[model samples]
Target chain A: MEELKQAILNKGVVVSNGVLKVDTFLNHQIDPILIAQMGQEFVKRFNGKEITKILTIESSGIAPAFTTALELGIPFVFARKKKSLTLSSNLLSAKVHSFTKNETNEITVSKDFILEDDKILIIDDFLANGEAALGLASLVEQANATVVGIGIVIEKSFQPGREKLEQAGYQVESLARLASLENNTVRFLEEVATK
Target chain B: MEELKQAILNKGVVVSNGVLKVDTFLNHQIDPILIAQMGQEFVKRFNGKEITKILTIESSGIAPAFTTALELGIPFVFARKKKSLTLSSNLLSAKVHSFTKNETNEITVSKDFILEDDKILIIDDFLANGEAALGLASLVEQANATVVGIGIVIEKSFQPGREKLEQAGYQVESLARLASLENNTVRFLEEVATK
Candidate 1:
């Protein structure tokens, strides 16, 4: 978590009205070593839980989720943002609103992938409004699967995302929680433990 | 390779007018063990190649590419299907047509990721028409980077994708090559080598 905070502090940029960009290593281009560590941390946090499958959204969450699932030796299923021509038949879906893109897209999962009685952990890059996490939970619910916990790489604690999920009775854990992005600087909610 | 061919034969279904659905293990719900094996194989084939980076398209390409990059101890950059609000001003862009989705989308990559002297290896889940690989190669060209090779998990040899990439003079390697799927049954181009 400290390293993640450092990465954000050293490389993250604030632009276009408080938007934090860490794509250089977190999103567009990935540092597998750092990502693998993040995955290990997630597994460490959920140490005793029997997670059958790891779940995430397409595009961004796939890498971290894949790494986490790899560490757990479990399979991962990512909800597709759009229904492709090759994907068909029965599907469990939910509408997700992306504040950045300023648009809402119907996210779906093939019903065949998620099975009832499977314990799933949801992972993502950032939790802004918690809409994406909630959407993923909906898909798991449709499958009659249990939502064990939600793991996030970065959480904008000032936003309503964390509170929203907690209100929905879901346990959420994030590696880096930003207390505020005020004055063009990142503030962590808690002190980062330095080695 | 034999395991990959076996996976396709066991879990793959030809649906929606000859579309092979390996979502159970390959695309939607990924079998991490199998994917990691595929990644290791990529490293095995491209041994001694000085690959600075692994390039892939978003969504499907991220998993295999990440694993390949992990095996090679290098970073990977995935081309975004569209421009995000957080993406930068200067970018390398290309127009890509998705036969599966029946649409064209402009994929962009941050110019900061790929370097001119970098030797990039493009990796993807499937090679059918080869349009995605070509588009990714175009991005590398814009960066003045060299594409050392193309790694594909599965190649539909009956299609023009493998031919197109080979014609373009790029070394392409695939774990499984389907000679034909014309009869709703997969026929391997060559007998998978059993270790």
Candidate 2:
């Protein structure tokens, strides 16, 4: 987490009060070395949990989830933002609203992938309003699967995403927590002593 | 690459005459262990190339590219299909037509990521008509970067993707090459005797 925090401070661009652009290394362009470390950290944090699969949203979430799944030796499934023609009709879906894009898109996964007895760990790149995370959880629930926990790369602690997932009775682990992004500066949340 | 070929023959589904769905382990639902091997294979295939970075499109391409970059110890960049609010105006864009979706999307990468003197290796999940690969090449060319070669996880040899890229003078390496998908069966193209 120190490396990630340092990377955020050094390379992360604070575009505005709530927006932090990590395109230089995190999302748009990726640093595989750093990402692999993050994955190891997630595996360590979620140690001893019975995780049958890793679930994530498409695009940004794929990298961290893939690495974590690689470390855990489990398969990871990415929910597609749009249903493609190749996708089968048997799907588990939920409507997710993106606060940044200000649009609602239906994210879906094939029902065949998530089985009834499976334990799913939800992972994503950023968690702001918890819409994407909650949507992923819904998909798992639809298939009668167990929600193991949620793993996040970067969490906007100023936002309600963490609180919402915690309120839903799911454990949330974030590598880098942003306390604030005000005045074109980056601030990280101090680690809670209990965690 | 025998493991990949066996995976395709065993789990790959022929949805139709032209479409072979490996969603079970390749794209929708991903097997990290296998993908890591695919990444290793890519590194072995493109060995000795001066690859400073890995370039790929978003979503499915991110996994293979991420693993390949991890193995090569280089940074990888994925072009965004749609411009988000957080993206800067300084961008390099290219139009890519998805034959499967029957749609064209303008993929963009941040100007800060791709440098003029950088040597890049393009990685993708599948190669069909070569549109996506060519689109990525154009982005590299826009930045005046040198493309080392293109690495594809699966290639439909019957399609024009490899031929087009080869004719365009880019070395194309595909781990699994499909000869045909007729009568709901998967057939791999025989390996060329010479490298």
Candidate 3:
């Protein structure tokens, strides 16, 4: 988590008041070593939750989800933002609102992939507004699966995302939780243990 | 390679005349064990190559690329299918035609990621028409980077993708090359072992 916070502090660019751009290493270009470490840490944090599958959204979440699934020795399932022609007809659908893109998109996952008795963990690169996480949780509920926890690499803790998920009765864990980003300087939750 | 081929043969679904869906284990729902094996195989095959980075597209390609990059202890850079506000302003963009969707989309990567002197290995889930691979290759070229090799999980040898990449002067390696699909039965290359 220290390495992630450092990487973020070093490379993360504040686009405006609230946007933190980390394309250099976190999103567009990935540091596999750090990602693997993050995945291992997630496994350690959620070790005994009985996770049967790792779920995430497409595009940015795939890498971290894949790595975490590999570390936990579980299958990884990602919800597709768009329904491709090659995808199966039977699917579990949920409407997710992206505040950045300023639009709502329907995310679909094959009903065959998620089992009713399985326990799933949702992982993603960023958690803001908590709509995406809620949408994923909705899909899990649709499949009659249990959401063990929500793991995030970077979280804007000032936003309503954490509170929303907590209200939904889901346990949330973030590697680096930003308490505030006033004056273009990032601040952590103060509870993070420094290495 | 045998493990991959067997996975395809066992779990892969034949949709139409030309479409083979392995979403059960490869793309939609990922099998972590098989993907790890694939990462090891890619490392073994491209052992001596100076792979500074692993390049791939978003979504499907990210999984294998991350795995292979993990095997090689290198970073992975995935090209985004669309220009997002989260991405940097400066980018290397290419047009890719998706055979599955019958649509052409622009894929972009941040210019800050790939260096001119970097040796990149392109990784992807499938190579059919090869348009996506070539587009990714063009991105490397835009960065003035050298592509040491192209690693593919599955290659439809009957398609033009392999031929096109070879003609473009890339050392393309596919774990399982299907020679043909006769009567809904997949016939892989004779020398290529299916696990």
Identify the candidate with maximal lDDT.
Answer: 2
- Residue range A1-195, candidate 2, lDDT tens digits: 999988888888888889988887888889999999999999998999999999999889999999999999999999999988888599889999999889999999999999999999999999999999999999999999999999999999999999999999999999999888877778788953111
**Which CAPRI level is candidate 1?**
high
List ranges where model 3 is wrong by over 4 Å: A191-195, B191-195
Q: How far does residue A60 in candidate 1 sit from its true spot (Å)?
A: 0.8
TM-score of chain B of 3: 0.96
Candidate 1 per-residue C-alpha lDDT over B40-154 given as tens digits, one digit per residue, 9 for 90 to 100: 9999999999999999998889999998988888889999999887775889999989887789989899999989999999999989999999999999999999999999998
List the pairs of residues colliding in candidate 2.
Answer: none
Best by DockQ: 2
Of 2 and 3, the candidate ranking higher by DockQ: 2
Chain A fold similarity by TM-score, each prediction: 0.96, 0.97, 0.95
Q: What lDDT does each candidate get?
A: 0.88, 0.92, 0.87
lDDT of 3 at A57: 93
Error of 3 at B122 (Å): 0.6
Q: Chain B, candidate 1: TM?
A: 0.95
Number of the candidate with higher lDDT, 1 or 2: 2
Model 1 residue B68 lDDT? 92
- Those runs of model 2 whose alpha carbons end farther than 4 Å from true positions after fitting are A191-195, B191-195
